[model samples]
Target chain A: MMVAEAQINNNTINLLEGWEEGLDKAPEWVQSFRKKAADDVMKTGLPTPAWEDWKYTNLRNLESVTLCEASSLHVVPNISSPFIDLKPIIVQLFNGSFVGEMPDLPDGLMIAPINEVWTNDWFKGFVSSLSIDTPMEALNSAFLNDGIVIKVSENTKIAEPLLLLSTYENSKDMLSVMPRIVIILENNAELNIVEHQSGIGSYVCNQATSINLGEKSKLGHYILQDNDRTQGYLFNTTKLNCYDDAVYDGFSLNHGAKLSRHEIFADLLGERIECIINGAYNLISTQHHDTTIKTGHFSPNSISKQIYKGVINHEASAVFQGRICVHNDAQGTDGHQLNRTLLLSEKAEFNAKPELKIYADDVKCSHGVTSGDLNDEELFYLRSRGIPEIEAKQILTKAFVAEVIEGIKDSVVRDIFLSISIEEGTK
Target chain B: MRAQLGRKKESNYKMIKIKDLHASIDGKEVLKGLSLEIPKGEVHAIMGPNGSGKSTLSYVLSGKEGYEITSGSISFDGHDVTNMMPEERAALGMFLAFQYPVEIPGVTTINFLRTAINSLRKARGEEEMDAISFLKLQKARTAELGVTMDMLKRGLNVGFSGGEKKRNEVLQLVMLEPRFAVLDETDSGLDIDALKVVSKGINSLRSAERSFLVITHYQRLLDYIKPDVVHVLADGVIQKTGGAELALELEKHGYAEFEKNQSNGAVA
Candidate 1:
């Protein structure tokens, strides 16, 4: 017992003490990954504002928040999506466990818990190959138990989108859940995955998703984070590996959560590939939101563009970090990134960092960062036209950030973005 | 050549009455105890040299930024408009055709016009106009001005040529249909053809219930849209008042005489 206590850090020990138990039924291979992740957390620690990557954000409750692995799950409450309701296949999970039977899926598609599908060599290699770097990601891998496994067979295109809602609620006053999601699209397969989270408890939900797109595959990924933010915290990570001719388009609408960190990593591994990552966030009333992105161009003729806008008001603060790295052999690569922020009050703050590293002379890569309050001339002009002060501000702020929503190609998704604007922002 | 006319005989049918006006911008006095009165349905032109407070008077009337009226009483129609906001003044039928129209990105001119019209209508508790009717009205208003559909589709004043911007301002004036409009140097950057187009647009809006205050440095525009009264403003006061013939007189004699008189008066 003393040696085990010495092996893992005090933080991980506290993480394993509550909920009356810890990780129960994960396999030997999974256990090995979990153990390594815990030891790594002991060696390094939580991120602080001093860290270069976390220069503007701090994880204050890493040691104090009462977090225990969700060893047991309760009932699965019924919930429906607010957008894209075309009778699509639905999978529901409760408190980090797959609690209900899956609905009928399209041909050549399968959905199951990770334990039931780990026999596939590719699946095992992918799960075992993941290495955790940060504290939250390490926590995700260590206590991770139940999550969805999606497999889309080669050459099949699903017309309708697939929905996955991970709902967290229980009688417990505090809970910590690590829900892992793995999506595998075979060669030339196409699919749209819509993932959402909602809950009504003090739960720290650390969610992670890994995507493996085979040659010529296409994936449209969207995340809806509309949880009970007053009593919950959410940390999310999405990793992408794209093959030849693959296209990965991702958009996230962030409107809730007390403290949320969404980090996305994309690696363009094959020739003639593209990746588009765009999102918008509205932080209100002391809420804090941070989005960190890192995309690498390793092969020739690959393109990646990142655009994100944020509106912060009422003592709230936000941070956005975007970085693009191009290798020497990626001569024909093109990378573009931009982050624009609007502060609606004197107490509101926003920070942005855009980094570009290019070793190849033939590559074209650029990044821009800007943060400001509303323009006075624009305000006066609109108000002078008899528009009320409130509405004049809404029109100006909405126009300042509407370009990101217009970037969406799907009509339904675009409408959904318009409906959730983080409140025209009260000063 | 026509005989000159002075300020119309004092009448009870007044549109704008300014008494004991003293205004400043950035702590520098511009308008010092200036006063004027414009009767309804009249087009009065104000002629002054550079830094003579011609633009300041226009801005003070329109409720623009950076101008403070330290002591003044400006009555529009019947309401005391000295404390009204810019939007409030706009709702009360006041419009300022900017000399340098601000360039706003991402807002199209069509959308701006619709928003402005609807705001005014909503203030008056009138129903907002539908898109079909708005487009129809816009087509009729902009048809004779030679404004293309492309100009209306672009961002407000963004990438527009100087003449195009002035024409756009006139286009707004026609759409708003205000009771008292201030055209501040609207003729500064226009060529002869564009000037005629702009003047025609403004002229089309002239009605017996409407009044206009046209401020200009030259008399060229008066030839196109004749004014009822012409006032030579110097030292923040009207030093001479006459008819449209006064504009022709100033064009021939220049503002040298007015400057010389003001200097001599100061020395005395």
Candidate 2:
């Protein structure tokens, strides 16, 4: 334990020194946030391996790298093949800084940087409600720079999704970019948001996004991370705050990156709120992917459902840890979580831990996990019908992954996800 | 486009010939040197009692797992194909209608059939079937089998009843058009109506280019799909080989004498 503490302190000192030198080109507000973030990083160093949440995903290698500042801002970006053609309220971030091109504004949708409203009393109070217990979340708040802030007016519905694209170009040196975003939906409003993270070369990305839904509001959010093989480390922290009768649906699909971690936390504060979380990950060849989700039902009569699936091939590894907590006061809560994994190679590995901690006696909660290969009887049946071995395996794998993809409401995005998943499964 | 190659002389010869075949599953010997021959342009029925190794012969011929060939060989179209992968045997135009078909969740019937047909076509050096043409052919075949388009849209054998699953097997047989088919207890769980529908589909595919080995425990299905020869499979061996009247004899007298004879012979 002492050794782990010492290593974390050393990493914090290295990061602070790098931040002090890297903030010269950043904005004034960003520089201020960095100073506070560096202080917090020192106070809360690295998470230990014994930590229950980080037990399956090791961060030893990520802490040792002396990441530099962003140096690829001058390079031209290839912006072709944007996912959707609609004129959404687009906010493009290039290496943690806001770009100039903005889309046409919608009637009830407002898009701006979080710093623009940081001084406002109402927004400041709301930002204070965010959980800063974890070091990663604290670091994101301390280094808070230019992340998009979306606001949906009360009783309004936006047909087009709000698109946020975070792009990382190849830097001349080893660099790390921390992008933080916050979203708020007013009472009785409906909105959809998609966060797309992509990069061209090796770089470390640390992203934090917070969503607060007002009373009776509905929010659908999708996170897609598809970077190049050269991209090294990714840490994403997403939190949600739900009110009475509010609905939150989120789906995450991860396809690339050498090492990636997605951590989600949801706090259901009001009665009768509904939340659904679905995710799928496809890993191949030395890639390490991790997804950790936790939901706390603080109020009575709240409901939550989660399903996460993974397909690991070659020497890749994936980890899924899901936990649901129903407090003593949270009676009549209903929750379920299921995690399944398919191992395609002998060397490939998968670790799944789904936990349900219910202190309320009147709650109904259950969790299950399974890991195995394709069934032999099913394989023989297909072969007896004239399907070859390789094609049979491919077909079975595609069907396994389709369970998660079927939840996507958008047809175009669903098609793209299916095609990419099949291609990866066949390969 | 590649032209269809000339049909080889072996295609005209008797397609499936079994001679003194001995097999077992889980160390329990099932087929005790059972011998039967299915010549081209003819369909033969094998009627037997329970634990008669009728299904064992079908599994051994198609190369199913856990069934070891202790002795003898199975020749298909002049080629020794006793030891081949299930897909390899299928690609060589050998089809087996399982008595209890396995359900493959999430794989649509249309998609599976298209893949199977294209794989066989590709193996024969023939042009691949396009999507439109394949759909047109599938619709005609499913209609002839009395299966609706909705059944084909669902997962293979998922939520299907006993008769529906048997009809699904026949649907594939018609679509694939295999040279030699082994129906392993295909009529075990079917009612009169389903049996007639299944037999009608089977009879429609009868031709000089194809042969069938129908394995059943009842003589009722044989009444509909008439057989050229009837063989009694008792104690893993062909106890009696006679005309179609042999089925009536077994249906009436049962296999008491056959079992006694095999037990006495075992003691010697």
Candidate 3:
């Protein structure tokens, strides 16, 4: 391990040496977090196949490439298909650094840089209470320059969603972007958020998002990552802390990037709390996508349901690993998880591992996963009806993905997601 | 005899002709040079016992995969349809209702029907149907078929009872208004009430321009729809063809004699 770290450090010394100049401008707390995170990252290093959680995704290529701190480029921002019609407070992060334009946010909503929050005593204390065990989270905290910090006021309802857009524009340089976002919804407050991360060229985007929900609060969160064909690595971890009677609905659609990993952890702390995680990913060519979600039921009468659907075409690959941990004290817990995959081509691959760790025997918990191709009888029936083979396949694929997309309550976002999925599926 | 000959001439104007069809699956022959013609403006029932290639004929005519047509020719409305794809056959106004309708988990029946209708219309060089007109037409057809609007809104055949799936297939036939339909054991799992409803829907779609090839193992469905001709499929061949009484006769006599004749032919 020591020799490996030494080799990695020697190979990536040029990538790690440039941050000293930027440290002078960062806040004191940001500098301290970065130092600790850099040290932890050096000790832990990039994950290997030996790690159980990352066994399917190989990060050896990521270690070989020397990463450079991404800077603000002069490229114009392109808004192709806006998923929703809400007038969101847009906070744009271009290549890991904040682009200095902040939209007029609603009253009681705080949209500021992460470093700015580190300076504030209240938010600093709030973040200190949350767990940050993963090395990626530590790295994000350490290198965090300008990421969005959303603070919703107590009992306030936000009419529009908050849009956090992370774009990668500079491909001429090998870039590493570590973006951090923290959203805190107060008691009885209602909010909707859309996080969009996309890049044009080969880049490494490591993002960490933490969401905290107060008592009786309702939140709808959407994550859309559609990047270019260039080799890209994305590490996203979303943590949700729910209090009593709070309801959280999260939908994630990952359609791009060469290799992507999404980790979500939901801690149901309060009684009567309900959380729904719905996701869909479509992979083609040689792309690889992996999603790992864990929901911990700490309090009694908490319910969480997860459904993840994926379609892998050509030689692409996908992985879905979901775990539901119900504590002994958490009685009357009703948790169900289902992962279904449609392999469009024989060469494509899908792997699903659903685990249920229940300490309470009284709880109702179940999980099922199925991987298969389109049904021959169904295809024949459609063909017999005079529908062409391609059209039949398109219809079947659309139907397979519709259930997950329809889980999104927002019509505009659902429509956009469905249209994009259909367009990409046919292509 | 002269009236029968004239009726045959008129049937030739609009009918599907299957000439000495031979189809196999995984090298096991199912349809062994079986041949039959279903004339327009009439309903024909093909009743057979288990392992009698009743479903094979339906699949082969629909151009389903895995069923290799070793030697056969199928013509629909004067066009050679042996090599046509499923959608092409559907665009030609041909429909097949499977005994076990597939469960499309996420797609709503309404959306699927609209897409199928529009696809067929587009293939025929016709403009797309607007949502309002499509819904209006669907409402009338579904109401006649006794299908609730909620059924149409749900995922196609997902969580639907057996009878509901059969009725939904009939609803599609009514909506698409196909010129020819092959209903393969549509009444297999349906009870008497559902059978009557489904049969009524099929009966309403009957016309001089449309034809039906109803495939079933029981004679009960024939009692409801009444076929112009009844054929017995035995050992991958049509062993006998007669009027509606033949169904009642086969139902009472069973297919033992036909099976014996098939084995004798094999031995010869």
Please state every model's RMSD to the true fold in angstroms. Answer: 5.1, 4.8, 3.7
lDDT of 3 by residue, B161-257 (tens): 9999999999999999998999999998999999999999998877777889999989999988888899999888899999999999998999898
Across B1-268, the per-residue lDDT of candidate 2 in tens digits comes to: 0011112214545678888898877777878888778778677898777777788888888888878998999989888888888888998899999989988776788888899899888877799999999989988988888998888987888899999999999999999999999998899789999999999899888877788899998899998887877888777888888877888888888878777655322210
DockQ of predicted candidate 3: 0.63
* Model 1 accuracy (lDDT, Cα): 0.80
Worst 10 residues of 2 chain A by lDDT: A1-10
Ranking by lDDT: 3, 1, 2
Candidate 3, A124-189: lDDT as tens digits: 677667776565575565566656788889989988877777788655656777777888999999
C-alpha lDDT (0 to 100) for residue A7 of candidate 1: 29
The deviation in Å at residue A334 for candidate 3 is 2.8
Give the best candidate by DockQ: 2
Among residues 3 or more apart in sequence or in different chains, the pairs in candidate 2 whose N, CA or C atoms overlap within 3 Å are none
Compose the digit string of candidate 1's lDDT tens values, residues B4-75.
222343444899999989987777777888888988878899998877789888878977777889998899
Q: Which docking band does candidate 2 fall into?
A: medium
Best lDDT goes to which candidate?
3
TM-score of each: 0.85, 0.89, 0.91
